[model samples]
Every structure is written in structure tokens, then in C-alpha cells.
Target: MVRKQTELPEAVTIAIASLRDGEKSKVGDAHDLLQDAVLGRQGCLRTDKPQPVDWAEAAWDEFITLMAHDNNHARSIAGQVLSNLAQSVPPETALRDLDKVSAATRDQMFVTARHVLQSMWKFGLGTKEVRRALVAEFADLFRISGTEKNPTLRRFDIVTGLRALFDETGDDSLLQTARDLISLEDDPTYRKKYSGVWRDLIDR
Candidate 1:
């Protein structure tokens, strides 16, 4: 980055160092100095203007490093960055180095995916293509997660819930999924939560 006539290289170096630790990213009220240093409020960062995004771009690994930061909010910021990039960037550009992000981010990935689903759908995932993709990805997750050993299949109710919320087919297919998941359950706990997912679908 091009340094301003009066700016010292060492100070910019120190600022970037603090940013890497996430200490300077508070986005706090000391806007005038922060803007001058990073985003350049009144052209304070003549040469360092490009460095902050560059730092963020580089700190992807650092973000993953901070994934287990003692603070959950810090973890969330890391996930949000991944989520934002996933939504706006082409899969090719955003995921070109998936191997780097994937192995490190297994836990954070689901949290980000749920954010994507919620932010994009703003309701139950509807529409054939969207539900198709959700089913492809999340159906299995929902199925085996609610139980263990002889795990109860919850994908059926989840899919049915989507059909009902969307009023899509609301048909035999959804009904069959319901039956399949319920039949796997010997435990009576699902007699409520699982049943609740499909009661309206069954009646309709």
C-alpha cells in the first residue's frame, strides 16, 4: 500500500497487526482515527487504503483460527464472513480453495448454511428447486440428528412441513415420507414434535 507523505510505515504495520487479532475491528465510536487508518475518512490512509480488505482476505485462515475463540460472538463473525462470501460469490470463485476452508470449518459450515437458508428464504424453504437443493443437503441432517442407535428418521416430517408451508404438492409423496419416518420411531417422544410437523399435512 502507498503510504501518505506524513505516515510512518511502522504505525500502519502496528495497526494491521492489531486488526489481525480482531481487536481493532470493534467498529466502535472512534471513527475518525479508524477511518483515517483503515477505510480512510478524509484520505488519511493514502497508501494503506487497500490493505484492510487485503488483510481480511488474508485473515481467512485467521478467521478459521478464531472459530474456537472463547467468545461465541467472535465465532459468529467468522461464520458470517463465510456466509456472505458464499451468497454473493460464484461457487467457483468463492469455493476454489474449498479444501482449505472445508476441513477447518466443518462446524461453522452448518451454522452458515442455516443462515443462508433463513436469509434467502425468510420462511420455510419453498419452491421445487430450493426444496430440492435443501432436501439434497439438509434432509439427511434432519433425519438422523434427532435420535440415536435406531435413529428416528425426521426427514419425512421436515419435508412434509415444507410441503404444507408452501402448499406445494401436499400429496401422496409427502404422506409416504411421513409414514416412513414415523415407522422408524419406537419412542413415543416423537408422538408430539414429529406429529406436529405433519398433522396439518395429513389432514389436508
Candidate 2:
């Protein structure tokens, strides 16, 4: 059993502060430190299994608040970290904040939006309700992506996220959904690229 932590580590606290500082010089180092701290507690984050962190209870609120920070970097970091913590925090908490984190995918800065999108697949590792809600959210986002800048890229990420969720849950519907979305890509080159994402799954 993991011992619950009651507070953020000093370094993590300092890093969060620096990230909020809005100074470019401090942002980089702060990002590195906070990421390291999160990864250290979360273990191999790429796994389908949820690695609940001891400190997540202490850190969730702060990260949730930072998702709306004025600095895009802070928002990006908050979204990514919150996605990582989805499996660690209570299912209700994760479900409650899901839309807030999803909002970051529409951040004004495309890079920040992409960062949030890339990490959001992890939320599928939460409870069944969260997973279903996330699929619905991704579907809605993909359907409306045509009006967004770099629609193809946004579609690619959405499909990629679905593939990730499918891989983790062995959900056939998710894979089929991804394939169907790929078929809608009018650009042959991009369609092939999107298809490549499921190559291994197709082989299986």
C-alpha cells in the first residue's frame, strides 16, 4: 500500500511557483523539475495500468487551478499533469475536471493545445464512466475540428488518442471508430498517415 503524501515536495512547490512566474528563463527549468517529480511518482506513465501517485491527493487541486493560468506553458503543464493524475485521484474528481482539461486542447496557442491533446489519452485509464465520457469528448472534438487551424493534425491526434485508448482497453469499437474517422480524411497522404497509426492493431 502506498503511503499518502500530505503536501507537495519543496522542489515541486518551487517549480510550480517558477512556472507561474511568466519568465521564460525560469519556465524551462521549472517545467523540467515538475515533470521529473511527477514522473518519479507515477512510474512508467505510458503503461495502460494506472500508477496512482502518493502525492496526487495533495497536488490535484493546485494543478486544476493552474489549468487556467495566464501563461500558456503553465496551462500546458497543468493539463498534462492533470491527465497523468487522472488515474491517481478519485474517479469523481477526475470526471468533474475532465472538461476543464479538455478545454486546454483548444488553447489559443496551438502548441499548448497539442500538448494537452497528446496527454489526454491517459484519462481513459480511469473508471468506465471517465473512459466513456472521454470517447464522447474526442468524437465531438474531431467532428468540429474542420473549423480549427490544422484540422488534419487535430484529427490525427484525436484518432491517435482513440487508438491509444483501444490499445489499453482492447475495445474494438474504439478501433473501428478511429478507422471510420480516417476514412473521412479526403487527403490521401494524410489518410495513409492516419492509417499507419493502427498498423500493428490491424495486423493483430
Candidate 3:
């Protein structure tokens, strides 16, 4: 007979302590237990049947409460938890608490990914897919760039996305324009983002 996997008592302790709403803090022992329970590496609380999916839901709720914990550790822990959820596929679970996630991601790009997720609800984002989809609407976004009513989207963040948009829309001219727009941007990261595509287009 096979021995059953132990649901470490620590797992329950952490889950209970982490249940406080707005109780942000750095990853503590509770987070570790949560991670183990959900990730299954450290130890599956119930070996009989893995509880990663269930653990994930509880973690999500706990993460929201931790968002306002007023502690760097708590915020960071919560951020990682949410990021894991965003990156999951077949989406072991759907983010029913989208509004809360959105609010949390507003300050940190790490968290801001949740905002990009808005696109996911409609389309999806995985670097390639998001860039391709974003291109279809690049013109609309660009149209607002220099206007009074612009949406204030992070243009730098949209460069590669626009490149993809151009690819799908067959708007080569915009590629040249994009190259010109970023011509003076000193940030190498921004240049690295799409300069290759623009340079390749110019050469072609």
C-alpha cells in the first residue's frame, strides 16, 4: 500500500493567517506553504490527489488581501502569486477577481501585466500573439499619441506591438515612421525592442 502525502500542518496555518484582507507582507512561511501546496514541489498537502488548482483559488483571494498589507514583502509575495496565475494556461482557473488584480498591477509593471490581461479577455498575450493582435489597432492607438484625448498608453511598451500590428496590416510606411519616432529615444532597451524589424524593413 502506498503511503499518503502529508498536507503539512504548516499549510493550514499559513492559509489561515494569510486570510486577512489587505494584509500585505513579504513571502513568509505561509507563502512558502502556499507555494508548495499549489506548486506541488515542496510537498502536496494531500498526496492522494494534488490540490494545486484548489490551492490556487485560495491563494488568489489571500493575495488580494495582502495587496494592501503595507509591507514590501507582502506586496512582492502577492505580486508573484498573481503573476503565476496570469501565466498559467488552460488557465487551471480563470481570474474571477479581475478588478482587484487590475488595481494591484497599476503601480508595478510586474503587476501591470494584469492590465495587459485586459487584452487577454478579448484576445490573448504571449509576446507573439499580443504583438500581432495589437497591430490591428495600432493606428487607433497611434492616432491618439499626439492628440489631446490620447489614452496615455506607454508608447515605448507598444513599439514591438506596433511592429506586429504593421506586419498584419501591411502598413510598412508606419514601420518607417515608428523607426523615426524612436530615433531619439536614449533607452537602449526601447531601441532593442523593435529597431531590428524597422532596420530590416528599411534594408528590404
Best by TM-score: 2
Q: Tens-digit lDDT track for model 1 on 1-204?
A: 221223233433443334345554541222233344344343321111212233333334544555455444344444433322232233343344333333222344444333222222111122344334433333444455464222233333344344443443433554555556555556677645566666665556
Over 4 Å off, model 2: 1-5, 41-50
Candidate 3: what lDDT? 0.44
User: Of the pair 1 and 2, which is ahead by lDDT?
Assistant: 2
Q: Is candidate 2 or candidate 3 better by TM-score?
A: 2
TM-scores of all predicted structures:
0.36, 0.86, 0.40
Question: lDDT, candidate 3, residue 97?
Answer: 42
Compose the digit string of candidate 2's lDDT tens values, residues 41-105.
43433332445667777888888888778889888878887887787777778889899988989
Positional deviation of 204 in candidate 2, in angstroms?
6.5
Candidate 1: where are CA atoms >4 Å away?
A: 1-71, 77-131, 146-183
Clashing residue pairs for model 1: 2-47
In what order do the candidates fall by lDDT, top score first?
2, 3, 1
Give per-residue lDDT, candidate 1, residue 180: 61
Task: Write the number of the candidate with greater TM-score, choosing between 1 and 2.
Answer: 2
Candidates 2 and 3 compared: the better one by lDDT is 2
lDDT of 3 at 27: 39
